[model samples]
Target: MLALKAENISKQYRLGEVGTGTLSHDLNRFWHKVRGKEDPYFKIGEANDRSSKGNSDYVWSLRDINFEIEQGDAVGIIGKNGAGKSTLLKLLSKVTKPTTGKIFTNGRIASLLEVGTGFHPEMTGRENVFLNGAILGMTRKEIKRKFDEIVDFSGVERYIDTPVKRYSSGMYVRLAFAVAAHLESEILIVDEVLAVGDAEFQKKCLGKMGDVTKGEGRTILFVSHNLPSILQLCKKGILLEHGLLKESADISTIISMYTHNAESEDIIPNSNKDVYLKSFKSYTEDDLESNLQTAKNGVLEFNIYSNKNLKNVKIGIGFNDDMGNRLFTPFSGHFQKMFDLSIGENTIYCTLDNFPLKSGKYTCEIYIGDNTETLDYYDKGLIVNVKDNFTLEKPDYSQGYFIINQKWTNERK
Candidate 1:
């Protein structure tokens, strides 16, 4: 059965650079409301701010995104930031109304868009639980029945009576997630709210989510920036790009496509300083150039150009799988050496012959640090793809970050 269906859904928003402009837009909307006329800006006949010098029109956050999910399917929504993942979820959760199209759902939806969402800081944890439950259409008797279980599961029983404003950040998350999980809704939609807590809490949340899918017949829509968690928890995947549904497929194939086609121009900066990263040129094999992707067990030679004399300068490289887990980290620190270069121009080269890694995608992070801390960091120093031609024994669990050649002998079972 189709638990949720979004048909030709689209959302549009107007960009306002100045604060005073909002009053004019509000008045226009009010006048349109009184006249029984539709908002003229409903149609997305607007240019993006990036392409135009000064254009005032609507920008589409989602454009005709159409999909349906069956009951009991755990679907992962994957995309680069600003790919309209959150916008779709918001529309589904009914936090914001869609500008066009319709959404059909079989049952109530419980969404955890952000930590402490739907939580009242002034209210006690216990009170908020009941408040949220009531908002989800639960009866007082129903909430009372699950009250202790929720408190115990959250591990916040000690502060259940305290106002949420006084609760620690972790405590607030625990209580909030507990309410969402135990609400017994037909569908659950969770965003990247798990990134804030400690690893143990994250594991607990993942385990609870897994159980929610396994033990209950509920449908789940999960959105996250962490690809590994998505792949591990979701069997089906949906990819979004530029507010459009790009593809829906198996998790593995979807992740591979996302990483390979990932681009940096989509990044929005929190500050101007964040947008201007320090620039440095790199080369390979005595050539002054960039872009390196070497084969497995092949030699990798590097040369870096820098103007300032860097302190505690260490040349390092690491190997990561498609999900961005560091499988290996090799650094010049192992050699107990540091670079003290002369000011102005300097160049250095290092060679790694027969690198110890199986065929996969890996990234090298270069750093220059002082004795106190890192002065500069370059995350994408090198992006390498390793290829191996020889046939090798594969492990039973070959999906980890690396492939190590380990000997195995099994007795008769």
Candidate 2:
């Protein structure tokens, strides 16, 4: 059975200022409505590309997006930062109406789109739990039954009676998620609310969500930037780009496409005024540029383009899996090494030794700093691909991120 379905849904917003700045445009829409004709501005909406300005005054935040999610299935929504992710959630949650489409859902929905989304700040956490439960059409008896479970899961028992306005952001998300998850809603919508919580709490929340879907067989729609969490929780995934539904598939395939799109952009912003990074590259042992993927043992070189330089410069690079987990970071300070550069140009090199990390695409961060301050930093400066030079028999070898270097030997079983 289908739990939710969006049909030809689209949301359009007027550029600059609010709603049809001129009376003429407003009158035109009314005239069309009166004549039972299409609105004059309906066809003028441009695609939502924030990189450049458009000629039209209207742009579609989401255009003709269609998908259906089944009951008892968890679906993950993945997209860029401004890819209408929140907009779609808002539309589904009934916080706003679509400009031109319909969304169908089979059961009651409880949403925690943001911190304290459906919460009243002045109300105590205890009262808010009941209030949210009531809003979800739960009886006071039902809420009372789940009250202890909710408080235990949130780990905010001490502050349950305190007014939520005084609670920190993390506390707000904790209690809010607790209520949403424990309530008797058939479909739950969560939108990156776990990000505000601590790492331990985030892990707890993911575990609870897994139980909600797998054990109790509830439908869940989750939006998050944490790729690993999404992979663990959701079986199906959808990718959105510039307000359009680009791809829908299993979680792994969707993530692969999304990362490829991001890497293709190759965006490295130079926020440093003094020293700028011209190029960051990985090379083979024989000295060849291998940016995409290379063997475990290779060289990572950074070419610095500077107007002027000084002494005691420190550099470092960090490697992270796609899920934002830091595998390892090597800093020059580890070896008590520093460099002195000339006036116009500089080059820095970092080498790897038998790095048998599992074969997959990884992202690296480059930073240049002095003892006192940082001269340049790129969060995702480059994408490093590690190839599996030594293939193993087991499939888990391909899935593992880190390789064991120790040799295995045994006399008998």
Candidate 3:
């Protein structure tokens, strides 16, 4: 069943001043309306490309977007900044109207698009919960029935009676999410506002969203820059580029396309005459290139060219998934080790014993520096692909990203 559908949706905004300009564009539009013809400015509007300057005053934040989301399906809307991600969410949430086309939805929508979106700053948290519930078409009886659960989930019981204006940003999001998730809204819309929360709180929110979709059978539209979270929570993906709907497909395919096209490996040069990264590579136990396969014992090696001898240098490596979501970062300082760089060249190697990463493509980020300043940094320096071996049968990617070696014991009663 289709829970939501958007047809030829587009939103346009002026570049600088509001109201179409100094009465010229407005008069032009009015003249077109009087003649029963299409607006002339519509044809002159340009795409919302933030990187380049356009000649037109009006830009389309979203243009000709068409998609259908099935009931109980979680869809992730992903794109670079100023790619019209938030604009689409706002259009769907009715925060703003599209300049053209229409949207149809089957059920009530509760959106947590931003911090304190529907909150009244002067109202108490307890009052705001009832107000938001009422706005979502819930009766007072229903609000009261779920009030305790919402307060408990938010973890702001002590501040429930206090005015929300005094609450912190984290507190605002907690209460907003609790109300949006717990209330009887068949569809939920969440933007990148979740990035404001801490890591543990974000995990908890993701778990709650999972429950909402899988356990309660609700529809969700999530917009985020965090690719791992999108991959973990959504089954479908919609990619937008410069206000246009680029692709809509299964999550994995969309992720692959997005990552491959956006992949970059540029080494940043430092101003100081210190150490700089020259090359980085990974090798398997067989001394073969680790681009495809690596044995249990693999080595990540890098070379640094230095102008002068240095001591107490810090080196760090970050492992990220294809979509540029960092999984883990290991630093030399964390191991209580100091690095010394010779004047000409220096080599550093990190060994992976019994590499636990599952079969997948990963990117490596390299950083070389000291406590005071950074010498060199490379984003997506090297690409490593881990292949599945005969070590395990039927590996599960959903259980976790990596395979943990652990002993299992059974007690028979």
Candidate 4:
């Protein structure tokens, strides 16, 4: 059975105004109501496109979004900023009502939408746990049963009796997630809250989320900018573009679509006055379409246009799978090398001897900085595809990240 469903869900917001707007729009809405007609303002709203400037004052943050999630399923919602990802989650969590359409859910939901969500600053950590639990429809007895477990998992036991206002941002999220994950709830909704926590804590939260769906058979709706976490935890993915449902499919396909459609604008100088990364591209030694065969050499070429001569500059490149998981990072500092970039254009080339990456689609992230200051960085710079060269049987995706050259022998007992 489906645990959650959304039908024709759309949220409209008036730009630069609170509530409806001027008295004229209000009167128009009231007149439509008296005439037994739908809200006239709904017709004037435009899609939530951020790239273009629109004339309408009202914009549909989410337009006609429809999807269903089965019980025990973990779904990831992915999109760029202003794509209405948070709006959809707010509607599902009942934190805000949709401007149009309905959402149906099977059981109680515990949401960790942001840092310190549903937490009382004046209350102690221990008290907030019980308070949030009670708000989620958990009885005091049930909360007490899981109280110690939550405290332990959060790793903030010493501050249990301290007021939440005194806690750091990390501590706030740690405690908040601990309460939501441990309490009894059939549906769990998490936004990018994990981004605030440390790496170890994020891993713990991911593990707990996996357990919540696998061990308890609960449903999860996760929204994260961290694609690796989403890919690791979610079996299904929903892509949103400009407040519209772009696609819903398996996690791998959705990730592929997302990466392929990402904006690849050339790096240009902005208000930030530092080293400028003009362009970056990757290709095989033969200058092919950036496609590499297994155990073959490749080249990563990039140009840096600097405003001032840079000394002791470090350049780094990261290889990531389609899901944005960092497979490996090659840094110039690792080789104890630094660049003396003169004021103008300087091109640097790095070669990958016997590329270890297996057959898959990958993207590049470029970083140019020093130990003291950051010059420039580009998260999505270039895209490349790797293919297998040998006729041997291809390994499954889960086997590993690379196909290494190894010699295998069997000895007689």
Candidate 5:
């Protein structure tokens, strides 16, 4: 049985404004419709590529998307940031309507699209729980039966009577997630909102979601950047790129494609904002497979674009393990080398005598900021693959990522 189906769904948005278009464009759309012509702006939309400046005023956040979720299936939606993952979730959650196409879904959907979604700030946590339950079509009595369990799971019992506005972001997400999960909704739609919670809470929530699908046979549509958690909870995956359905397959296959794609996830799109990382490149210290070889000399280059000249700028680069923990991060300001960014372009290169990471896949983190404000920060600045050593067949990765070279010889008689 199909739990949900989306057919040719596409979402379009004007570059600057929220609603359909400006008055002139609206009049154009109206004029075309009067003549029984297709919408003019519909043909004007370009793909949702954030990295480049486009000529079109309209962009398709999602285009011609078609997919189906089987009943009781937990499906993970994987994509880069700004790749229409959240837009698709919002459409399915009915937070917004698609510009075109249809979505057919079975049963009630409880969505945690963002922190404190559907929550009224004036309402207390306890009141908000009931409010969310009501929104999910649960009777007051039904909520009462599950109320204690929800409270316990959230671990926010002491603050249940406090106005949710007074609660911390962490508290708000915990209560919100608990309410969504405990309610008897047949379909659960969760965005990357769980990232707001601490590690322990995230783990707890992941476990509950697993049970919701495997034990209770509920359907789930989850969108998250955390691939390991996605693999653990979802049996299948849907990959989207530039607002189009790129691939739909088992979770493992989707993960492999997402990681190994030739197009780099390292590049941050050019922003209309003040400044951002334009491109990141790992140099020619690659092995035979064109992968970054372990324990080899290399340079990481960053080309940053800025709308205007900036001062007191500092660039920080983090070498991270696969688990997203920074092994070490180097900061420019620490060396009293506060760099300057020209109005148009700035280039910074970080060199390594021997690449630090062992043979593994790692992520490089980049942050550019100044004394007062942050210019740009890319947590997954680069997804790096470290293969065998340039010299050794197998690099020594015994105790840690960094290898220390050593040698001993007999002294004089």
Candidate 6:
């Protein structure tokens, strides 16, 4: 059975010169409510024209969004910031109402869109746990059954009795997530709240979410800036752009479209001109320039070009495993010496040596930045295919990621 459904859900907000929404709009809405009539300005929703750039007008945060989630389906809502992914989740969670359209949900919907959501800062972590669970429609006894596990999962057992206001931003997020995950909610709506946690905690949350969708058979709506997370945890993805639904389908395909569309507009064609940063093409021997794929032990090279009077351009390549873990980071800066190049054009070469990696794909990230900060970033510079390395004895298959050439001796007493 379908757990949740939304049809033509849309939200509009009035923009101000500075701030998150305006109190003036709120007052106008309130005064109109007392008069028992719609506000005359309701027809003039946020304006989009450049002439009215700074004027007070309602802007659509979500427009004509439609989707359905079946039981145990993990749907990822992805788009650039301000694309209404969060607004959609907020409407679904009932934190905010849509300006138009309707939604039907079969079960209790719990959402964790921000840190300390539905939490009382004055209350202790232990108290907030119960409070949050109760707000999610859980009975006291039901929350009691999962209390200990929630505390453990949050890693805040020591401070369970401490006021949440005293906790660090990270601690608040941890406890909030713990309550959201443990409480009995058939439908889950999670925004980028996971991004606040450290790497380990984020991984833990991902595993927990996976368990919820796979083992517990719950429906989930997740929004995230981490594309790889969406690709990993979601079977389906919904793309939203400029308050409109772009597409929804296989997670990988949607993410590819988003990634491509995101970069297509900003990226100038590869040129040999005097600029801050130049674009390099990713290609293979057969001239398959885009989406190049190779078998294990494959060789791929970047056709790098430099077109400025440059010094100290620290060129580097980073390798990330399929799960988005940084496997290796090597840079020319390690050598301390900068490349001396002519003004018009030049090429820098990088080759993957030894290729001990197992059969899987790896993403190469290229960087060209000032010594202090990153000026330009190119993720998925090249996707290299690593074929299986035939070992003499059946591979142990126990070691985690990256072939480690370590010597070990075992002794039994």
**Best-matching candidate per lDDT:** 4
* Residue-wise C-alpha lDDT for candidate 5, range 1-413, written one tens digit per residue: 89899999999999889797889988998999999999988888899999899998889999999999998999999998889999999999999999899999999999999999999999999999999999999999999999999999999999999999999999999999999999999999999999889879999999999999999999999998776678778999999998999999998778777877733335646486689988876654443236555567766677889989888888888776644566877678778888888998798876666766677666676788989997887753266666666554554467678764556779855
lDDT of candidate 6 over 193-295, digit per residue (tens): 8877887998899999999999999988899766567667899989888778889898877866776644311333334334233444433334344322222
TM-score between candidate 1 and the true structure:
0.73
Q: Which runs of model 6 end up more than 4 angstroms from their true locations?
A: 17-56, 264-316, 325-330, 333-413
Error of 6 at 378 (Å): 9.6
Superior by lDDT: candidate 1 or candidate 6: 6
Listed per model in order, the count of residue pairs whose N, CA or C atoms clash below 3 Å is 0, 0, 0, 0, 0, 6
- Please, what are the lDDT tens digits per residue for candidate 4 over residues 1-413? 88999999999999999866889989998999999999988888888888899999999999999999999999999887788999999999999999889999999999999999999999999999999999999999999999999999999999999999999999999999999999999999999888788778989999999999999999999998666678789999999999999999998788778767553333433435567778766668875564567777877777888888879999998888755678999889999888899988899888888888988776667889887887877653255667777776777768888877776779755
Across 5-40, the per-residue lDDT of candidate 1 in tens digits comes to: 999998877665332237777798789989999876
TM-score of every candidate: 0.73, 0.79, 0.75, 0.84, 0.72, 0.68
lDDT (C-alpha, whole model) for all candidates: 0.69, 0.82, 0.83, 0.86, 0.85, 0.72
Poorly placed runs, candidate 4 (over 4 Å): 263-280, 285-297, 301-310, 318-328, 340-348, 363-384, 387-413
Q: Which candidate is the best by TM-score?
A: 4
Clashing pairs in 6: 45-58, 46-57, 46-58, 46-59, 296-386, 296-387
Candidate 5 is scored at a TM of 0.72
Q: Which pairs clash inside model 4? A: none
lDDT of 6: 0.72
Candidate 6 C-alpha error for residue 149, in Å: 0.5
What is the full ranking by lDDT, best candidate first?
Answer: 4, 5, 3, 2, 6, 1
